[model samples]
Target: MPRYRKRKQATQRKNLIGSLLIFAVLGLVAFLAFFRYELQNKQLAYDTETLCPSNITSPKYVALVFDKSDAYNKIQQQFLRRFFDDFKANLLPGTRISIYVIDAHNNKEIAPDFVVCVPRTGDDANALYENPKLIRQRWHERFEQPLDLAINGFMQPAQADFSPIMEVFQTISLSAFPLGSETVPKQIILISDMLQHTPEWSHYRGQMDFSKLQKTLYYQRINTDLQQAEVNILYVRREGMEKLQNKRHAFFWSDFIQSIGGRVTLIEKIDG
Candidate 1:
């Protein structure tokens, strides 16, 4: 009876040990799985071509058109710099920004000088899981620097006989925000003197008559579909053109933009 009791006691100890081992293994596996999931959640994934976040299904589109037909004064430059700073700050992650420069000499094809999507920055990072410094550094290198360089290069003054503001707007509409596609949110920031001068139509030709403008062949050629885009006109004041650039001029532009399916949200004048 004593030998049998000793064997039973030994068998009970082995079973206890086996159960503990199994529980420990399962706990370790659960811990590993949880750690891997946390790491994945903290990490950011971006597309190679668009630089947009992989998780983003719909991203906002911002198009900036800098009309460099005339030189900007010191005051105007300072305002523009500050405006750009704010613009950069307000941009959300995964938003695509395209910067286009319209020069004095009109090119047959208009393309964006800089195009990039805002990447995940330190603000979007988790401190416990990821290094914010590295993420911010990558954002600055990949997005901020190149954009600043492109903008600075285009900010230089250029003199031309004609400022094709209308043609450039049409081109931007067709290329950036095409018709029948309202899936993505669109915004256009136009920094210009608001002087529409082209061979077909010229704001310099006395007063702007919207009725007459509609009758011209130039008006007929406008197949621009802004697709309900939000237009922000940063009107740069031109020297000795007070008669041309007045309340009437502003109204004409607002009316024109509205006529083309665009909503003129802001028509702020950049005072020089």
Candidate 2:
């Protein structure tokens, strides 16, 4: 009986030891998982650009200046929608987007009429969120809606007959962006026919002369500095204009804009 009791006691001790070992292994695994989670969070927090990067990146200011005189066709709609889709993806913390109209009466001023401004704010709290769906939802709710509304509003036909693109450019470069931050990226997206048809210079009447513009008071009046802003002119092709004329118009504007401080980056023809 004494020998049997001893064997039973030894068996009980081995069972207790095995249970302890299993618990220890489980605890170690839990600790390792927690550590990995914390490390990933830290990395994401450091790397994420929450509205403003921890590093030095200039604020981006985008102006979508549209010529109200141009026909708002389906092709223009598609291109603009595509642009907005890309814009949604690339939007960072310190980005501002504005829509303007190049109309006939600019209050007798050399400036485009302001339509709306969509500015992006940073979400520091959600920067390290594990789920990307929530992040996109936030962006769509805040930034995307306002931009879409502005575009829709601009798509409506205006009563203006003339398109003063030069004045619009000058206005945007001079007054649209904040005055103090010249180091930031200033982008002007022009949606027009690339044909300047103002009271001063009419492209249809063959009175479009760049040399005379320099000599006139209008040039001096609209000679506001762009501070090396980039211009992307998305020329909307009209129904009657020849292919050669369109090409010439694009080239003329490219050279004309570059003559000023603006760097004309794109001169694409949008067929409607």
Backbone clashes, each candidate = 0, 1
Where is the poorest 10-residue window by lDDT in model 2? 44-53
lDDT of 1 at 75: 91
lDDT per residue (tens digit) for residues 157-223 in model 1: 8888888887776777766654444878899999999888887778898748777787777787874
In model 1, state the lDDT of residue 6: 98
TM-score of each: 0.83, 0.69
Over 1-272, each residue of candidate 2 has an lDDT whose tens digit, in order, gives 99999999999999999999999999999988987887564342222322322343336777788777756788678887887687667766546665688778766653434433332333443444444566557566755675677677787778667877787777777656666768888888888776777777777877555676678887787677777889987777777866435555666776667767889988777656
lDDT of each: 0.81, 0.69
Cα RMSD to the true fold for all candidates: 3.6, 7.6
Q: Give the TM-score of candidate 1.
A: 0.83
For residue 21, give model 1's deviation from the true position in Å.
Answer: 6.8
